[model samples]
Target: MVIILIRTVKYNLSKLRDLYLHTTCLATLANMAPHVHRLSAYASQRLVSLFYMLSRKYNKLTEQMDDKVGKGGSVEHDSLAKDMSAELHIYADFLRIVLEILNAILTYALPRNPEVVYAIMHRQEVFQPFKNHPRFSELIENIYMVLDFFNSRMDAQTQNGEWSVEKVLQFIISNCRSWRGEGMKMFNQLHFSYEQESHPEEFFTPYIWRLTLSHCGLSFDHNAVNLFTVDLPAEQLDNAGEEHDEPRQNGR
Candidate 1:
Protein backbone atom coordinates (compact mmCIF):
# COMPACT_ATOMS: atom_id res chain seq x y z
CA MET A 1 0.00 0.00 0.00
CA VAL A 2 2.78 2.42 0.86
CA ILE A 3 4.63 1.61 -2.37
CA ILE A 4 1.46 2.09 -4.42
CA LEU A 5 0.74 5.42 -2.75
CA ILE A 6 4.25 6.69 -3.43
CA ARG A 7 4.03 5.68 -7.10
CA THR A 8 0.68 7.41 -7.43
CA VAL A 9 2.05 10.59 -5.95
CA LYS A 10 5.01 10.57 -8.32
CA TYR A 11 2.75 9.98 -11.34
CA ASN A 12 0.46 12.86 -10.40
CA LEU A 13 3.39 15.18 -9.79
CA SER A 14 4.71 14.36 -13.27
CA LYS A 15 1.36 15.24 -14.82
CA LEU A 16 1.17 18.47 -12.83
CA ARG A 17 4.61 19.54 -14.01
CA ASP A 18 3.63 18.89 -17.64
CA LEU A 19 0.38 20.81 -17.28
CA TYR A 20 2.14 23.75 -15.66
CA LEU A 21 4.76 24.01 -18.43
CA HIS A 22 2.13 23.92 -21.18
CA THR A 23 -0.82 26.24 -21.89
CA THR A 24 -2.95 25.17 -18.94
CA CYS A 25 -1.40 27.72 -16.59
CA LEU A 26 -1.51 30.47 -19.19
CA ALA A 27 -5.13 29.77 -20.06
CA THR A 28 -6.11 29.84 -16.39
CA LEU A 29 -4.37 33.17 -15.87
CA ALA A 30 -6.18 34.65 -18.90
CA ASN A 31 -9.55 33.37 -17.70
CA MET A 32 -8.95 35.03 -14.36
CA ALA A 33 -8.22 38.40 -15.99
CA PRO A 34 -11.79 39.64 -15.70
CA HIS A 35 -11.06 40.19 -12.02
CA VAL A 36 -7.51 41.15 -12.86
CA HIS A 37 -7.22 43.85 -10.26
CA ARG A 38 -7.84 41.42 -7.44
CA LEU A 39 -5.93 38.65 -9.13
CA SER A 40 -2.90 40.87 -9.67
CA ALA A 41 -2.96 42.01 -6.09
CA TYR A 42 -3.11 38.46 -4.73
CA ALA A 43 -0.46 37.19 -7.08
CA SER A 44 1.91 40.04 -6.41
CA GLN A 45 1.51 39.69 -2.67
CA ARG A 46 2.24 35.96 -2.73
CA LEU A 47 5.26 36.42 -4.99
CA VAL A 48 6.63 39.20 -2.85
CA SER A 49 6.20 37.07 0.25
CA LEU A 50 8.08 34.14 -1.23
CA PHE A 51 10.91 36.34 -2.52
CA TYR A 52 11.18 38.05 0.82
CA MET A 53 11.60 34.76 2.65
CA LEU A 54 14.23 33.48 0.24
CA SER A 55 16.21 36.70 0.33
CA ARG A 56 16.11 36.94 4.10
CA LYS A 57 17.10 33.33 4.80
CA TYR A 58 19.78 33.20 2.13
CA ASN A 59 21.40 36.44 3.25
CA LYS A 60 21.21 35.44 6.89
CA LEU A 61 22.91 32.08 6.28
CA THR A 62 25.66 33.45 4.02
CA GLU A 63 26.40 36.29 6.37
CA GLN A 64 26.67 33.93 9.31
CA MET A 65 29.06 31.66 7.41
CA ASP A 66 31.13 34.65 6.32
CA ASP A 67 31.29 35.99 9.84
CA LYS A 68 32.42 32.65 11.20
CA VAL A 69 35.09 32.24 8.53
CA GLY A 70 36.34 35.76 9.11
CA LYS A 71 36.79 34.92 12.80
CA GLY A 72 38.78 31.73 12.00
CA GLY A 73 35.96 29.49 13.03
CA SER A 74 35.77 26.03 11.43
CA VAL A 75 33.23 23.93 13.36
CA GLU A 76 30.46 26.52 13.15
CA HIS A 77 31.14 27.07 9.46
CA ASP A 78 30.74 23.37 8.64
CA SER A 79 27.62 23.16 10.80
CA LEU A 80 25.98 26.12 9.07
CA ALA A 81 26.90 24.77 5.64
CA LYS A 82 25.29 21.42 6.47
CA ASP A 83 22.20 23.12 7.86
CA MET A 84 21.63 25.13 4.69
CA SER A 85 22.46 22.63 1.94
CA ALA A 86 19.29 20.59 1.52
CA GLU A 87 16.72 23.29 2.30
CA LEU A 88 18.36 25.77 -0.06
CA HIS A 89 18.50 23.19 -2.86
CA ILE A 90 14.76 22.70 -2.46
CA TYR A 91 14.13 26.46 -2.44
CA ALA A 92 16.33 27.01 -5.49
CA ASP A 93 14.44 24.36 -7.46
CA PHE A 94 11.12 25.93 -6.48
CA LEU A 95 12.31 29.38 -7.56
CA ARG A 96 13.49 27.96 -10.87
CA ILE A 97 10.11 26.32 -11.52
CA VAL A 98 8.34 29.56 -10.64
CA LEU A 99 10.50 31.67 -12.91
CA GLU A 100 9.95 29.15 -15.70
CA ILE A 101 6.19 29.39 -15.22
CA LEU A 102 6.32 33.19 -15.33
CA ASN A 103 8.53 33.12 -18.42
CA ALA A 104 6.12 30.77 -20.16
CA ILE A 105 3.17 33.06 -19.60
CA LEU A 106 5.11 36.14 -20.59
CA THR A 107 6.64 34.47 -23.62
CA TYR A 108 3.69 32.58 -25.14
CA ALA A 109 0.48 34.03 -23.66
CA LEU A 110 1.67 37.62 -23.65
CA PRO A 111 -0.33 40.69 -24.64
CA ARG A 112 -3.44 38.57 -24.01
CA ASN A 113 -2.34 37.70 -20.49
CA PRO A 114 -2.04 41.23 -19.27
CA GLU A 115 -2.92 40.21 -15.75
CA VAL A 116 0.34 38.30 -15.39
CA VAL A 117 2.19 41.33 -16.65
CA TYR A 118 0.32 43.52 -14.21
CA ALA A 119 1.06 41.27 -11.25
CA ILE A 120 4.75 41.09 -12.15
CA MET A 121 5.06 44.82 -12.63
CA HIS A 122 3.32 45.50 -9.34
CA ARG A 123 5.99 43.51 -7.49
CA GLN A 124 8.97 44.17 -9.72
CA GLU A 125 10.97 45.57 -6.83
CA VAL A 126 11.04 42.19 -5.08
CA PHE A 127 12.61 40.63 -8.16
CA GLN A 128 15.46 43.12 -8.49
CA PRO A 129 17.43 41.73 -5.53
CA PHE A 130 17.61 38.30 -7.16
CA LYS A 131 18.40 39.67 -10.67
CA ASN A 132 22.09 40.04 -9.98
CA HIS A 133 22.63 37.52 -7.19
CA PRO A 134 25.31 35.13 -8.36
CA ARG A 135 23.19 32.06 -7.66
CA PHE A 136 19.83 33.29 -8.99
CA SER A 137 20.79 35.82 -11.66
CA GLU A 138 20.46 33.41 -14.60
CA LEU A 139 17.04 32.22 -13.48
CA ILE A 140 15.69 35.79 -13.71
CA GLU A 141 16.86 36.95 -17.13
CA ASN A 142 13.62 36.27 -18.99
CA ILE A 143 11.63 37.99 -16.26
CA TYR A 144 13.96 40.98 -16.39
CA MET A 145 13.37 41.25 -20.13
CA VAL A 146 9.60 41.31 -19.63
CA LEU A 147 9.95 43.92 -16.86
CA ASP A 148 12.12 46.11 -19.08
CA PHE A 149 9.65 45.88 -21.94
CA PHE A 150 6.60 46.81 -19.88
CA ASN A 151 8.42 49.40 -17.78
CA SER A 152 9.52 51.22 -20.93
CA ARG A 153 5.92 51.27 -22.13
CA MET A 154 4.68 52.51 -18.75
CA ASP A 155 7.28 55.30 -18.79
CA ALA A 156 6.10 56.43 -22.20
CA GLN A 157 2.48 56.49 -21.00
CA THR A 158 3.40 58.56 -17.91
CA GLN A 159 5.21 61.08 -20.12
CA ASN A 160 2.17 61.44 -22.40
CA GLY A 161 -0.24 62.35 -19.61
CA GLU A 162 -1.91 60.95 -16.51
CA TRP A 163 -1.61 57.18 -16.89
CA SER A 164 -3.61 54.47 -15.23
CA VAL A 165 -3.92 50.67 -15.14
CA GLU A 166 -6.75 50.82 -17.66
CA LYS A 167 -4.55 52.61 -20.15
CA VAL A 168 -1.73 50.11 -19.58
CA LEU A 169 -4.03 47.17 -20.27
CA GLN A 170 -5.38 48.92 -23.37
CA PHE A 171 -1.88 49.50 -24.64
CA ILE A 172 -0.92 45.85 -24.16
CA ILE A 173 -4.04 44.67 -25.96
CA SER A 174 -3.44 47.01 -28.86
CA ASN A 175 0.31 46.91 -29.35
CA CYS A 176 1.46 43.40 -28.59
CA ARG A 177 1.82 40.51 -31.03
CA SER A 178 -0.18 37.29 -30.92
CA TRP A 179 1.36 34.04 -29.73
CA ARG A 180 2.28 32.80 -33.19
CA GLY A 181 4.94 32.99 -35.90
CA GLU A 182 7.75 35.23 -34.71
CA GLY A 183 5.83 35.77 -31.50
CA MET A 184 6.08 32.04 -30.73
CA LYS A 185 9.83 32.29 -30.35
CA MET A 186 10.93 31.91 -26.77
CA PHE A 187 12.99 34.59 -25.11
CA ASN A 188 14.38 32.11 -22.60
CA GLN A 189 16.61 29.11 -23.25
CA LEU A 190 15.44 27.25 -20.13
CA HIS A 191 13.30 24.13 -20.54
CA PHE A 192 13.28 21.99 -17.45
CA SER A 193 12.52 18.26 -17.53
CA TYR A 194 10.69 16.59 -14.67
CA GLU A 195 12.42 13.30 -14.09
CA GLN A 196 13.57 11.21 -11.17
CA GLU A 197 17.16 11.49 -10.13
CA SER A 198 19.10 8.76 -8.35
CA HIS A 199 18.30 8.35 -4.68
CA PRO A 200 15.40 10.78 -4.80
CA GLU A 201 14.32 9.48 -1.42
CA GLU A 202 17.17 11.40 0.13
CA PHE A 203 15.27 14.62 -0.63
CA PHE A 204 11.67 13.41 -0.42
CA THR A 205 11.68 11.44 2.81
CA PRO A 206 12.26 14.38 5.14
CA TYR A 207 9.95 16.63 3.13
CA ILE A 208 7.07 14.14 3.20
CA TRP A 209 7.56 13.53 6.90
CA ARG A 210 7.31 17.26 7.57
CA LEU A 211 4.23 17.58 5.36
CA THR A 212 2.55 14.73 7.19
CA LEU A 213 3.28 16.29 10.53
CA SER A 214 1.96 19.69 9.45
CA HIS A 215 -1.26 18.30 7.98
CA CYS A 216 -1.82 16.19 11.08
CA GLY A 217 -1.42 19.26 13.33
CA LEU A 218 1.70 17.88 14.91
CA SER A 219 4.88 19.68 15.83
CA PHE A 220 8.06 18.98 13.92
CA ASP A 221 10.93 17.85 16.14
CA HIS A 222 14.03 19.02 14.35
CA ASN A 223 16.22 16.46 16.08
CA ALA A 224 13.81 13.67 15.21
CA VAL A 225 14.10 14.39 11.48
CA ASN A 226 17.22 16.15 10.35
CA LEU A 227 20.04 15.80 7.82
CA PHE A 228 22.39 14.43 10.46
CA THR A 229 19.91 11.77 11.51
CA VAL A 230 18.71 10.78 8.01
CA ASP A 231 20.83 11.91 5.07
CA LEU A 232 24.26 11.64 6.62
CA PRO A 233 23.84 8.05 7.79
CA ALA A 234 22.48 6.94 4.42
CA GLU A 235 25.33 8.67 2.59
CA GLN A 236 27.91 7.11 4.85
CA LEU A 237 26.45 3.67 4.28
CA ASP A 238 26.54 4.17 0.53
CA ASN A 239 30.18 5.24 0.65
CA ALA A 240 31.07 2.19 2.78
CA GLY A 241 29.21 -0.11 0.38
CA GLU A 242 31.11 1.33 -2.56
CA GLU A 243 34.37 0.78 -0.74
CA HIS A 244 33.39 -2.84 -0.01
CA ASP A 245 32.58 -3.42 -3.68
CA GLU A 246 35.91 -2.16 -4.98
CA PRO A 247 37.97 -5.21 -3.96
CA ARG A 248 35.38 -7.65 -5.41
CA GLN A 249 35.23 -5.75 -8.70
CA ASN A 250 39.01 -5.67 -8.97
CA GLY A 251 39.18 -9.50 -8.50
CA ARG A 252 36.97 -10.03 -11.60
Candidate 2:
Protein backbone atom coordinates (compact mmCIF):
# COMPACT_ATOMS: atom_id res chain seq x y z
CA MET A 1 0.00 0.00 0.00
CA VAL A 2 3.00 2.25 -0.20
CA ILE A 3 2.22 4.70 -3.01
CA ILE A 4 5.20 6.76 -4.02
CA LEU A 5 3.93 9.83 -5.80
CA ILE A 6 6.17 10.55 -8.76
CA ARG A 7 6.55 14.33 -8.99
CA THR A 8 7.98 15.78 -12.12
CA VAL A 9 9.96 18.97 -12.79
CA LYS A 10 7.18 20.05 -15.16
CA TYR A 11 3.65 19.96 -13.78
CA ASN A 12 1.04 18.34 -15.97
CA LEU A 13 -2.42 19.86 -15.54
CA SER A 14 -4.19 16.56 -16.26
CA LYS A 15 -2.42 14.79 -13.36
CA LEU A 16 -3.47 17.42 -10.86
CA ARG A 17 -6.99 17.49 -12.26
CA ASP A 18 -7.35 13.71 -11.92
CA LEU A 19 -6.15 13.75 -8.31
CA TYR A 20 -8.52 16.61 -7.55
CA LEU A 21 -11.41 14.79 -9.23
CA HIS A 22 -10.69 11.67 -7.19
CA THR A 23 -10.72 13.76 -4.03
CA THR A 24 -14.06 15.31 -4.92
CA CYS A 25 -15.49 12.00 -6.03
CA LEU A 26 -14.56 10.31 -2.72
CA ALA A 27 -16.03 13.22 -0.75
CA THR A 28 -19.19 13.06 -2.83
CA LEU A 29 -19.69 9.31 -2.36
CA ALA A 30 -18.75 9.35 1.32
CA ASN A 31 -21.37 11.97 1.95
CA MET A 32 -23.97 10.03 -0.02
CA ALA A 33 -23.31 6.57 1.46
CA PRO A 34 -26.30 5.28 3.44
CA HIS A 35 -24.44 2.87 5.73
CA VAL A 36 -22.03 5.53 6.83
CA HIS A 37 -25.28 7.11 7.98
CA ARG A 38 -23.71 10.53 8.01
CA LEU A 39 -26.02 12.07 10.63
CA SER A 40 -25.78 15.63 9.38
CA ALA A 41 -28.33 17.08 6.96
CA TYR A 42 -25.67 19.52 5.85
CA ALA A 43 -23.63 16.67 4.37
CA SER A 44 -26.55 15.55 2.23
CA GLN A 45 -27.23 19.14 1.15
CA ARG A 46 -23.56 19.60 0.29
CA LEU A 47 -23.64 16.42 -1.83
CA VAL A 48 -26.60 17.72 -3.81
CA SER A 49 -24.93 21.07 -4.30
CA LEU A 50 -21.62 19.50 -5.39
CA PHE A 51 -23.22 17.15 -7.92
CA TYR A 52 -25.33 19.95 -9.37
CA MET A 53 -22.28 22.12 -9.74
CA LEU A 54 -20.37 19.37 -11.53
CA SER A 55 -23.29 18.71 -13.83
CA ARG A 56 -23.58 22.38 -14.68
CA LYS A 57 -19.88 22.61 -15.39
CA TYR A 58 -20.08 19.62 -17.70
CA ASN A 59 -22.96 21.18 -19.61
CA LYS A 60 -21.20 24.52 -19.91
CA LEU A 61 -17.97 22.92 -21.14
CA THR A 62 -19.88 20.88 -23.71
CA GLU A 63 -21.63 23.99 -24.93
CA GLN A 64 -18.34 25.80 -25.24
CA MET A 65 -16.89 22.87 -27.17
CA ASP A 66 -19.83 22.96 -29.57
CA ASP A 67 -19.41 26.69 -30.06
CA LYS A 68 -15.74 26.33 -30.80
CA VAL A 69 -16.28 23.55 -33.34
CA GLY A 70 -19.37 25.07 -34.93
CA LYS A 71 -17.54 28.14 -36.19
CA GLY A 72 -16.16 25.76 -38.86
CA GLY A 73 -12.70 27.41 -38.66
CA SER A 74 -9.49 26.07 -37.11
CA VAL A 75 -9.73 28.04 -33.87
CA GLU A 76 -7.34 25.67 -32.19
CA HIS A 77 -9.53 22.59 -32.01
CA ASP A 78 -6.99 20.91 -29.75
CA SER A 79 -7.84 23.24 -26.93
CA LEU A 80 -11.52 22.46 -27.31
CA ALA A 81 -10.78 18.76 -27.45
CA LYS A 82 -8.74 18.87 -24.28
CA ASP A 83 -11.42 20.79 -22.44
CA MET A 84 -14.13 18.40 -23.57
CA SER A 85 -12.00 15.41 -22.66
CA ALA A 86 -11.39 16.68 -19.13
CA GLU A 87 -15.09 17.28 -18.60
CA LEU A 88 -15.90 13.84 -19.92
CA HIS A 89 -13.37 12.27 -17.55
CA ILE A 90 -14.83 14.08 -14.56
CA TYR A 91 -18.39 13.15 -15.51
CA ALA A 92 -17.40 9.57 -16.12
CA ASP A 93 -15.72 9.50 -12.73
CA PHE A 94 -18.97 10.79 -11.28
CA LEU A 95 -20.85 7.98 -12.90
CA ARG A 96 -18.43 5.46 -11.44
CA ILE A 97 -18.75 6.99 -7.98
CA VAL A 98 -22.55 6.87 -7.99
CA LEU A 99 -22.59 3.28 -9.20
CA GLU A 100 -20.14 2.23 -6.51
CA ILE A 101 -22.24 3.93 -3.86
CA LEU A 102 -25.36 2.16 -5.06
CA ASN A 103 -23.60 -1.17 -5.00
CA ALA A 104 -22.36 -0.59 -1.46
CA ILE A 105 -25.83 0.35 -0.29
CA LEU A 106 -27.51 -2.66 -1.80
CA THR A 107 -24.77 -5.05 -0.83
CA TYR A 108 -24.23 -4.01 2.79
CA ALA A 109 -26.95 -1.58 3.86
CA LEU A 110 -29.99 -3.74 3.16
CA PRO A 111 -31.35 -6.26 5.64
CA ARG A 112 -32.30 -8.78 2.97
CA ASN A 113 -29.37 -8.70 0.58
CA PRO A 114 -30.99 -11.27 -1.68
CA GLU A 115 -33.93 -8.98 -2.35
CA VAL A 116 -31.73 -6.39 -4.01
CA VAL A 117 -30.23 -8.71 -6.58
CA TYR A 118 -32.81 -7.79 -9.20
CA ALA A 119 -31.86 -4.13 -9.01
CA ILE A 120 -28.64 -4.93 -10.84
CA MET A 121 -30.64 -5.28 -14.04
CA HIS A 122 -31.30 -1.55 -14.13
CA ARG A 123 -27.66 -0.52 -14.46
CA GLN A 124 -27.84 -0.07 -18.23
CA GLU A 125 -30.73 2.37 -17.94
CA VAL A 126 -28.77 4.39 -15.42
CA PHE A 127 -25.62 4.59 -17.54
CA GLN A 128 -27.21 5.08 -20.98
CA PRO A 129 -26.06 8.68 -21.30
CA PHE A 130 -22.45 7.57 -20.92
CA LYS A 131 -22.59 4.97 -23.70
CA ASN A 132 -20.49 6.65 -26.35
CA HIS A 133 -18.42 8.89 -24.11
CA PRO A 134 -14.68 8.43 -24.49
CA ARG A 135 -13.97 7.79 -20.81
CA PHE A 136 -17.34 6.53 -19.64
CA SER A 137 -17.31 3.06 -21.13
CA GLU A 138 -13.98 2.03 -19.68
CA LEU A 139 -14.68 3.55 -16.28
CA ILE A 140 -18.09 1.93 -16.02
CA GLU A 141 -16.70 -1.40 -17.07
CA ASN A 142 -13.99 -1.19 -14.44
CA ILE A 143 -16.45 -0.31 -11.70
CA TYR A 144 -18.73 -3.18 -12.59
CA MET A 145 -15.78 -5.52 -12.66
CA VAL A 146 -14.98 -4.47 -9.13
CA LEU A 147 -18.61 -5.03 -8.22
CA ASP A 148 -18.62 -8.55 -9.65
CA PHE A 149 -15.29 -9.39 -8.13
CA PHE A 150 -16.58 -8.61 -4.66
CA ASN A 151 -19.83 -10.40 -5.31
CA SER A 152 -17.97 -13.47 -6.46
CA ARG A 153 -15.75 -13.39 -3.43
CA MET A 154 -18.72 -13.07 -1.11
CA ASP A 155 -20.38 -16.03 -2.75
CA ALA A 156 -17.25 -18.09 -2.43
CA GLN A 157 -16.87 -17.20 1.21
CA THR A 158 -20.49 -17.99 1.86
CA GLN A 159 -20.12 -21.37 0.24
CA ASN A 160 -17.03 -22.10 2.32
CA GLY A 161 -18.87 -21.37 5.59
CA GLU A 162 -16.79 -18.28 6.33
CA TRP A 163 -19.51 -15.71 5.61
CA SER A 164 -20.30 -13.29 8.39
CA VAL A 165 -21.65 -9.79 8.57
CA GLU A 166 -18.31 -8.48 9.76
CA LYS A 167 -16.40 -10.21 6.98
CA VAL A 168 -18.77 -8.88 4.32
CA LEU A 169 -18.45 -5.39 5.68
CA GLN A 170 -14.71 -5.80 5.80
CA PHE A 171 -14.67 -6.85 2.15
CA ILE A 172 -16.66 -3.78 1.15
CA ILE A 173 -14.59 -1.31 3.15
CA SER A 174 -11.27 -2.73 1.96
CA ASN A 175 -12.19 -2.64 -1.71
CA CYS A 176 -13.59 0.85 -1.38
CA ARG A 177 -10.27 2.21 -0.11
CA SER A 178 -8.38 0.34 -2.79
CA TRP A 179 -10.60 1.92 -5.42
CA ARG A 180 -9.72 5.38 -4.12
CA GLY A 181 -6.07 4.47 -4.37
CA GLU A 182 -6.57 3.36 -7.96
CA GLY A 183 -8.40 6.60 -8.71
CA MET A 184 -5.43 8.66 -7.58
CA LYS A 185 -3.27 6.81 -10.09
CA MET A 186 -5.79 6.95 -12.94
CA PHE A 187 -4.32 10.12 -14.44
CA ASN A 188 -0.81 11.63 -14.32
CA GLN A 189 0.49 9.43 -17.08
CA LEU A 190 2.35 12.46 -18.44
CA HIS A 191 3.93 13.52 -15.12
CA PHE A 192 4.45 12.12 -11.65
CA SER A 193 5.30 13.64 -8.22
CA TYR A 194 6.59 12.06 -5.05
CA GLU A 195 5.61 13.27 -1.61
CA GLN A 196 7.59 16.28 -0.36
CA GLU A 197 8.94 16.48 3.21
CA SER A 198 7.95 20.13 3.66
CA HIS A 199 5.20 18.91 6.03
CA PRO A 200 5.49 15.61 7.85
CA GLU A 201 1.80 14.83 7.67
CA GLU A 202 1.35 15.93 4.04
CA PHE A 203 2.35 12.85 2.12
CA PHE A 204 0.88 10.73 -0.67
CA THR A 205 1.08 6.94 -0.76
CA PRO A 206 -1.28 7.20 -3.67
CA TYR A 207 -1.49 3.63 -4.88
CA ILE A 208 -3.16 0.98 -2.72
CA TRP A 209 -4.05 -1.67 -5.26
CA ARG A 210 -5.43 -3.76 -2.41
CA LEU A 211 -6.58 -2.85 1.09
CA THR A 212 -5.45 -4.48 4.31
CA LEU A 213 -8.45 -4.23 6.59
CA SER A 214 -8.14 -4.64 10.34
CA HIS A 215 -10.94 -4.96 12.88
CA CYS A 216 -10.63 -1.41 14.15
CA GLY A 217 -11.54 0.23 10.79
CA LEU A 218 -9.54 1.52 7.80
CA SER A 219 -6.02 2.66 8.61
CA PHE A 220 -5.29 5.02 5.75
CA ASP A 221 -2.58 7.65 6.33
CA HIS A 222 -2.99 9.98 3.41
CA ASN A 223 -3.52 13.76 3.21
CA ALA A 224 -6.79 13.26 1.36
CA VAL A 225 -9.22 12.14 4.05
CA ASN A 226 -10.67 8.65 3.59
CA LEU A 227 -14.34 7.69 3.95
CA PHE A 228 -13.86 4.53 6.01
CA THR A 229 -13.38 6.18 9.39
CA VAL A 230 -16.29 4.87 11.48
CA ASP A 231 -17.35 6.54 14.71
CA LEU A 232 -17.47 3.81 17.32
CA PRO A 233 -18.73 4.23 20.86
CA ALA A 234 -16.16 4.91 23.56
CA GLU A 235 -16.90 1.61 25.30
CA GLN A 236 -16.54 -0.36 22.08
CA LEU A 237 -13.26 1.36 21.21
CA ASP A 238 -11.74 0.89 24.65
CA ASN A 239 -12.66 -2.80 24.94
CA ALA A 240 -11.90 -4.07 21.45
CA GLY A 241 -9.30 -2.37 19.29
CA GLU A 242 -9.62 -4.43 16.11
CA GLU A 243 -9.50 -7.56 18.27
CA HIS A 244 -12.47 -9.07 16.42
CA ASP A 245 -11.55 -7.62 13.07
CA GLU A 246 -9.71 -10.00 10.74
CA PRO A 247 -7.33 -8.79 8.10
CA ARG A 248 -8.92 -8.87 4.66
CA GLN A 249 -7.18 -8.38 1.35
CA ASN A 250 -9.74 -7.08 -1.09
CA GLY A 251 -8.09 -6.78 -4.46
CA ARG A 252 -8.17 -3.64 -6.57
In the order shown, the candidates' Cα RMSDs to the true structure are 14.9, 22.1
Best by TM-score: 1
* Candidate 1 clashing pairs, residues 3+ apart or interchain: none
Off by over 4 Å in 1: 1-41, 75-77, 158-161, 178-252
Q: TM-score, each model?
A: 0.50, 0.33
Worst 10 residues of 2 by lDDT: 1-10
> Which runs of model 2 end up more than 4 angstroms from their true locations?
1-35, 73-77, 110-252
In lDDT terms, which candidate is top?
A: 1
| Candidate 2 per-residue lDDT over residues 56-125, each given as its tens digit | 5566667776776787735445775775767766665654554444445443443333222223321324
Q: TM-score of predicted model 1?
A: 0.50
For model 1, how does the per-residue alpha-carbon lDDT over 65-125 read when each residue is reduced to its tens digit? 6676688877445776666654455446545545654565566556556666666776778
TM-score of 2: 0.33
